[model samples]
Target chain A: MHDFFFYLFSALTVLTALLVVLCPNAVNSAVFMIVSFVGTAALFLLLDAFFLAILQVLVYAGAVMVLFLFIIMLLDVERSSRVRPDVVTVVAASVAVLLLAFGMGYLFLTGHDATAATMAAVPQVPGGANPMEYATASRAFGYGLFTKYMLPFQVAGFLLLVAMVGVIVLSKRLTGSNEAGKPSAQEIRESEVSQS
Target chain B: MNHSELLTQLSEQYVSTNQWCALWPEIALALLAVLVLLIDLFAGRLRARAVPFAAIAGQVVIFAVLLGKLGTCDPADSGLLFSGMILPTTLSEVMRLFFLLASILVCWLGMLYLRKQDLPRMEFYCLTLIVTAALMLLGQSSNFVMLFVALETVTIGFYILVSYGRNSIFSLEGGLKYLVLGGTSTAILLFGIVLLYGAAGDPSLPVHSGDSLNFLALEQFLAANPNNVLAKVGMVLVLCGVCFKIGAVPFQIWIPDVYQGAPTPVTAFLAVSSKAAGFIVLINLVTGPFGPMASLTVPLLSAITVVTILFGNLTALGQRNVKRVMGLSGIAHAGYLLLGIVALIQGVELAAWAVIFYLFTYLFGSFTVFGVMSHLAGPDDENQEVDHYVNLARRQPFLAGVLAIGLGSLAGIPPLAGFIGKVFLFVVAFQANLYLLLGVAILGVVISIYYYFGWMREAFFQEQTWPEGKEEQLAPIKVCLPHKVAMAALAIITVLLGIYQGGFGGGF
Candidate 1:
């Protein structure tokens, strides 16, 4: 059953992800991306990383997709084929994709052996009903985070705060009157250059 | 020890003592950032005058703590804090001092530049403090998790600071490029970390293997498994990511545009503090985790050094913009600094000291040029072109003199601090038998002189051409009080350090 579900989700993931790129319209691409994200989340769920699976859905599929859609709408993106795809770009991209696939294949082959060795090496908890028990899973995460990884956790807060400030500051627009009051120093420099 | 045993031991180590005192500076700065935000939001523009002062005052407090810790903490006393995450060694202490001093200078520069630019002022100070705290955190990170988080915090802060001049297209473009490239490099770095984690494997079963993400543990693992192919790949990828941050060759396409477009103060901060942080982390990784693998990294670093030096200096030769020149020159400096890292790998004891000394001199020299640029620039004008500075000495002697000293140091002229720093690095490289790299570095310095002198010549030698009737409109540049003081301070430090070199010697 697990094997069946894994194949199902993987197939769906690849299908939707392909659609996300191949779709001509911006809105259709965005919709396909959500489906792709959901497929990814399902795969995560199968891996027993339940927290990550839920976050993948809640953040990427829900909030982030909405933001993407908003941007697409605000920009009024059209599906015009103004410029033909260049052969050089296409060739370069294909080579890059092939290289990436080769690298990933090598990584996974070596990584699988390492992971097996690691799993065998880890000392299981005493009196374990199941060594991989999901009980206290989030608790385990919190314990490690608060204790050994406290500094990183706090730094993450500062990172988010900076992002917030950046977004607010960048999105702000100056009042029309403020812009019209006088020529800015830059304008003056340009005018001087032109006059000269 | 088993995984549980390791956790228990680390927890006991953390909970036993008040190790939190060692992190007082970072904590205070974090709180100061929050306070600045609150003040900015609540007080609005009414209390604008108080914000920068508060930021400067917080930096002063941090600086005081750094000074107090200097020469006081014995090497043996310096150890891990917050479990195994932080190693606040004396090395970190000195590096933190540099960060603080740089931050304080940035605040002064930002304040003057902000007022002139008429941009939002409060968040500039707040973010600078946050980034400084992050720098402190980065200097002390002994674990990969701490390193990544602290690095991200600094990068995020800079992304905002880079585009702070929101109205400028150049600023926005620079910020976007930095963000996209920085994000990609970060992903590459994380991938490398994951591979290393896999190669190290689980430490819990206690076959005496290293932990997944701890620097010390990784070092032990690398020493034990010298031929681990996966670990080698991981280390290479990690170096690539860091090279992006340091603006080394092959990862340097972003530097020129970003440096020229970022608010001049932000450019200075990025040029000094950001580059310093990258080098510090690189030193930590190369010396700590990859020490035993010097056989692997030495050749890699040598190739990078040669390319970075040749590429930076040669490309800079054709640049018309002053900021672009500084940006490319910074890349060349990174090459020189990398030579020191090679020396470190070759078992030279003074290599790290040489790097620190070089960075210290770089701070004063680069900031001298940046501070003058900040003062001369108006709200919408960068005044960054080489032509903009023609006959600047006739119009503003102080600014011109500061620029000359700054560029002179950068060009590695004798009797300046930069020259001394370069000599020390080259000596260490020579001691390590890196004659080829030393020769390359000397060539880079020579190439750099032509442009540096070009800038000086434009400022002092060229006649100020005011088109026919426009001569009456041109007025002498009026520098603000804070900028004046800051420029003067940097000039004095550069000259005095060049003459004395006492403090640098004693610190080692």
Candidate 2:
């Protein structure tokens, strides 16, 4: 049952990820990307990494996708008019893709034996703990995060704060007499529209 | 163990590992950043006058404290704190001081920059402080998680800084380009970390580690499995991500455009502090977990050095835009530094010191040039071209003289700090038997002289040919007292370091 679920989610992830890239509309691509993230979260759930799975959904699928959608709407990017690739670009891209596909195929087929052997040999968790229970417990994550990973966790908070400040600095409009006579977003949009 | 016992045990372990005192400088810097924002929030009218002074004064105090403690804060005594998350060594201590100094200079530059622009003032200083704190942490991090988080903070702060001049289209364009490329590099770096974690944590592997993200454990794992394919790929990917930060070739496509578009202060910050942070991380990795894999790293870095040197110099040759010229020449400097890294990997321990010394010289030289650039740049910050510098010597000899010393140092001219720095690196590289790389680097330096001199010539030698009626545009730029003092200090430091290597040179 676990193997079956893994395969199902893996296929879902790969298919949705391809659709994300292939979709012409930005909004459609973002939606597909969220689905792909969900598929990845499901796969993580199968591995008993429940905390990671939840974060994958919450952060990537929920928060990040919303941001992507907001940007697409704000920019009002038209459905990407497909620019046809030149012969050189087409040939180069195809050759690169084909080589990657070949390399991946070769690695998967041959590398599986070594990896499988390693996995089979290491069924028991180190320090005599039950891997499933330890991994599934949120308390375990809390302990690790607060103890060993405390510095990084605090630094991550600063990272988010910096990101927030950055967004405001980049997007906020100038006010007062120091506005420097620059055009407003609305004005620029109108001007662009008229020009088009 | 039962739940109560387990809880007690965890708390005990946390108490043992959480050494908060060791992180006082970082904590103080963060608090200073918050204080700057609060001042901005409350002071309102006074903020413009108050914040930059507060930010600079606060950092100067911290810098003094850190400098005083430098002798006592030995890494051997402290070992690893926060459960091996941080390992503060002599290099990291120096870097902490280095970052503090860089932040102070950047705030000074930002003050000059903001006075002329219509941007928000307080957040620039706030973010600069926060990023400096993060960079200090980055140099001290002994674990992958700590390094990545700190690096991301620095990069994100830069994203805002690079685009702080939102009124300028070029600034926004540069910020977007940096955001996309930086995010991609972060992903690549994270992927590499994950790969190493997976490979090293496999219990079937020799000397397998449960905490594979820690440098010591990963080093043990790599030493045991020298031929591990997964680990090798992961190491290469990680290096590639760092290369992007240092603006080495193949990862340097973003440098020219971004450098051209960013505000002068921000471009200076990126070129000096950001690049220095990247080198510190690279040096740590090569000397720590990736030490055992020197066989792979030495050759790989040599090839990159060759290309980076030649490519950076050749591309920089035709650039008329001064910032673009700086950007491309900065790439070549990265190549020279890469040569030092290669030597370190080849067992020349002194190469590490050489790299740090070079970075110090780079800071002095680059900031001097940037200081001049900021003073001369008009309201349209991005349009600073080489031609704008004509007749600069005749009009403002002080600025012209500073520019000449800065450029001369960067070109590795004798009797400047940069020349000494290059000599140290080359000596170390020679000790490592990197004769071919040494040749390419010298050739690259010779090529770089053409452009560096080209800028200097414009300032000192080029005849003024202002279009009729536009002669007023070329009037003498009023160099403010603070800027003059700062530029003079940097120039004096360059000259002093060149003449007397002192402790920095003698120690290595």
Candidate 3:
């Protein structure tokens, strides 16, 4: 029964991904992507990576998608006219499809038959197992993140910060009087060029 | 020895349990970051521009320390550090040292660039160290779990830094593209990891011979299950993600656009340190985790290298903006680095040397080019067009000369560092029987020259400057001693290094 659900959800995820990629409307594609993400969460649960599944739902399907939606809504981008397939995109897509077919063939031909015994090894750390402690699998993730994964986590945060700062500096038009007491970005740029 | 005893035994094999030689420099960098951040926080009350300079000075000292460590450190002393989330191999040590040096230089340039723009300083330098530290961890990671975190850290740093000059719509778009694509790639990599983990019998064991996610364990696993279809599939998927990070052919989509769109200093950082780190991680994976599976992995790598070289060089020819050209040329350089990686897979000692030399040379060449770009970037990044440099030799003679040398080196012209790096790679490729890749590389060099010389020609030979855009607010050119010093140092270093591939040593 679990296997049935697993295959069903996985198939749904994959098919929805195709829709996300191939769909004409960007907004529709985004909405479909959220569905695909949710389906993937279900598939993760079947595989017993339960924490990851909840993360998939909460972070990706919930938070990240919402952020993406915000951008889409905020931008209110006009519906893009139908894009004629570029040679590169078309070629890439075809190659991907071919590779996918080969992957499927190889899997079916060489893969072992799935069984329940094989699936039980990495048991899911049950949700609500200690929900009050950290609110989600994020607690263990945090522990691992700070300890073993501290370096990368910190770097990722900095990268985001830089990007944020960079974007702001790039967009803001300096008022003539803004630099009355401060050095203007223009002055800074000229001096930088002169120095180099 | 059992688990505890095994660690003890492993410790016994090394000089000292406390003496993880490869890890010292990284420890220094991390400590330095904390120190710099703390110092910066208190800097406002103390002095003007203290924090940024302190951060830069800290990085400079750390770079020197890492170099000192690299000079004396031996590869045989390589071992897992901190339970092997990070490892210290000759390859990673070299990579880390080079990364530190590059970060220092980029941060210095970034400071000047941002100062020119009148942006905040303390946060800028502090973030650079944080990002550099993240990259070091990324290069040293042996466990995929750590690997993901480290990679994410680097990605996040790049994402934020890329958009640091946020007022530009282009910079914002670059960051957005990077974020979305980066997240997708990370997800794909995780999926690949999960699949591999599921396939392994003892999932808790490190990946080599054991069932865990360790590089050495994975290497052993790969050996035992050479024909394990699942493992192979997982490997390919994981490789795909790493390739994206390196900005190689198949996943090279966002690179040129991002490079063109990002602030010049950040672009320099992205092209050099980020590209070098990608090579470092690739070296680790190829040498340790998938060492035995070279046969299958090598050809795929070679093909990508070939196409990437051809594609990058050819596309670069059409670019009108200098930054865009730099981006495309950077991609082509990635192709060259990939050739070095392909050479290592041949199991030849000479080939390994070639890879190292090529990486160091590539690093210098990239620095030279970007340093010159940093010199020419007009206020508000207005001097972006290729035509902006028309008759530059008539105006800013020194900047023009440095630009020439930088571009010449990038094009692999003789007597430049790029040429030496290329020759070393060609010899290795010949030995490795990668004739097709060698030819593609050679062809890339030829194509590269056209664009490089084309820019040089415009800069030097053109008698008149192209009229500025009607909307352009041309900032009068003012050359500073510090900028001149950066260009001269880089230009001289590139030439000197090209003369002999030995003395300046670093890179993964």
Candidate 4:
């Protein structure tokens, strides 16, 4: 049953992730990305990381997808796919495929014996139950985050704060369109045309 | 046994007041950032002077406190701090001083830079302080979680800083590129961490009980499972992300555009502090958890060094823009530094020292050049192209000399700090028997002279040309006192460090 579920979620994740890149429209791509993230969340559930699964759904599939959709809407890109498969794209794709093959080969060469041995070694509780196993993964996560990971947690907070300031500072316009400030790109192009 | 009891027990075990002192410098920097903001909010008419002055004064205090902390540090209490999150080793202490010095110089340069540019000086200083604190934290982070969080903090601050000149199309374009690339690298790094976690996360080791992300636990895990394919892949991916941060080849497409477009002082900060932070983290990773994997990483680093040095110098040969030249040369310097990393992997004890000493000299040389650039390029005009530097010596002799010294040191001329740093790195490479790498690095240095002197020639050898009716526009450039002071100070540091082979070079 575990193997079946793993294969199912992994297949769905790969399919939707491919769709995200191949979709013609930006909005469609974003929607497909949401689906891919949902597939990822399901995989996380299979790993017994219930909290991370929820986070994958809430933060990535919901919030991050909405943000992507908002940016796509703001830009109002055309459905027309003008992406020509140039030499650079082709080379990059080929290299990526080669790397993936190499990775898979390495995995096969190493085999799953190590993973099986590790699984066999996971300790059981005194009550003859796996209480400290996946059943308590979410609790263990919280415990780890609050204690061992506190410094990084604080640093992550600062990162978000800096990102907020960055968005505001970069997007804010200090000067109006007709001030004695630096010329806009349009104005500069126009002046160059006139000069030519 | 239950959740609340577990939480309580964890808190009792981990939380302590003594450990907080190890974090004093970071806390002080955070407070100083907020204080600068408050001063900006209330200073009203005095906002300009008050903001920068407050920042400089705060930096001085922080520096003193950090120095005191450094002096008082017991060598015996030298392992991981804060539950294995940060490791305040002697190396971190030394690197923190470098970060602080970079901050102090940046604030001074920013003050003079703001005189000509119409920028909100407050936010600039605030971001500088915050980034400095983040960099200081990065130096001590010994865990993957700490490394990622601190790395993101520094990069996010830089995103805004690189595009602070919102009015300029080039600036916004540069920032957009940086954001996209920086975000991609962060994602790659996180994925690598996840993979490593999956490969070695046993939940049995004490550190692993929380999260097997601690460097000590990770090292043990990797040692036990040396042939793990997933762990090797993750290590390579993480190294790639770090390579991007350091502006190495193949991951360095963003450096030139971003460096050229950023405000001059910011360019200096990125060229020095940001790059130094990247190296410090690289040292921590390569020397700490990644040490046992040297057989794999050495060849990888050697390849990166060869390509990075060759690419940085080859492309720089054709660049007209002085900032772009510096950007490419920065990549070349990263290659030279990576040479040290490769040597470290080969078990040369002084390789780490070579990397830090090189960065130390780079800070002075790069800043002196950038300081001169900021002073020359007023808010009204960006003196970007090397052509604009024609007859600079005749017009502004002081600025010209500063640039010459900066470029000369960068080119690794003898009797300069950069040359000393290069010699040490070469010596380490020789010790490691990295003769091929040494040859490539030497060739890179030889190739760098053409362009470094190309700018010097433009500045000192060529005569200024005035268009038929535009001669009036070429009046002698009047540099402000503050600008002069900063330039002179940086130039002095650069030359003095070159001449005096101080205790700084006696490996930490």
- In the range B1-508, model 3's lDDT, one tens digit per residue, is 1333433343354323234444556566656666666775675576346666777777787777667756585666554455566676666777777788788788777866775564545556656776787788787788887788777767777887776765455666777788898888888888878766655644433332332677777777778767666677788888888888888998889987788778888888888888877888888888887788887789889889988999999999998998889888888888988887888888755665666666777777777767767766755553488777877786678888888888888888898887888887787777878888988888898889999899999889976544557324545466789768877888898899888655433321
Q: List, in the given order, the native-contact fraction of each candidate.
A: 0.39, 0.49, 0.25, 0.39
| Residue-level lDDT tens digits of model 3 in A72-184 | 88877677788688999999899999989998788657754333233234433233233223323444454555444454455455556545644554445555425554556
iRMS per model in Å: 7.0, 4.1, 9.7, 5.2
Q: What share of the true interface contacts does candidate 3 keep?
A: 0.25
Clashing pairs in 1: none
**lDDT (Cα, tens digit) per residue for candidate 4, span B1-508:** 4545645665667665227667788888888888888988898889877888888888888898777777576633755477778887777888998999899889887876766665456788888988999999999888888888888889989999988876556666677789999999888888888888877775532324335688888887777766667778889889989999899997999999998888778888998998898889889888888888887898888999999999999999999988889999999999999999899889997888888899989998998888777766755423478877888897789999999999888998888889999999999999999999999999999999999999999999886566675645765677778778877887887788888867756653
- Chain B only: TM-score of model 1: 0.95
TM-score, every prediction: 0.89, 0.94, 0.80, 0.92
lDDT per residue for candidate 1 within A50-101, as digits (tens), equals 8878889999999999999999998797894756679998998899899878
For DockQ, candidate 2 versus 3, the one ahead is: 2
Tens-digit per-residue lDDT, B291-385, candidate 2: 99998899888999999999999999999999999999999999999999999999999999999999999999999999999999887789999
Looking at model 4 chain A, report the run of 10 residues with the lowest lDDT sum: A187-196
What class would a CAPRI assessor give candidate 4's docking?
A: acceptable
Ranked by lDDT, top first: 2, 1, 4, 3
Error of 4 at A48 (Å): 3.5
Number of the top-ranking candidate, with TM-score as the measure: 2
DockQ pick, better of 1 and 3:
1
Native A-B contacts reproduced, model 4: 0.39
User: Would candidate 1 be rated incorrect, acceptable, medium or high by CAPRI criteria?
Assistant: acceptable
At residue B294, what lDDT does model 3 achieve?
88
The lDDT of each candidate is 0.83, 0.89, 0.73, 0.82
Candidate 4 on A1-196: residue-level lDDT in tens? 9999999989999998999878888888888888889999999888777788999999999998899889888877779657789999999999999988987787668644444443445655444545546344666677666776677787787788777767666544444344464455556445334532
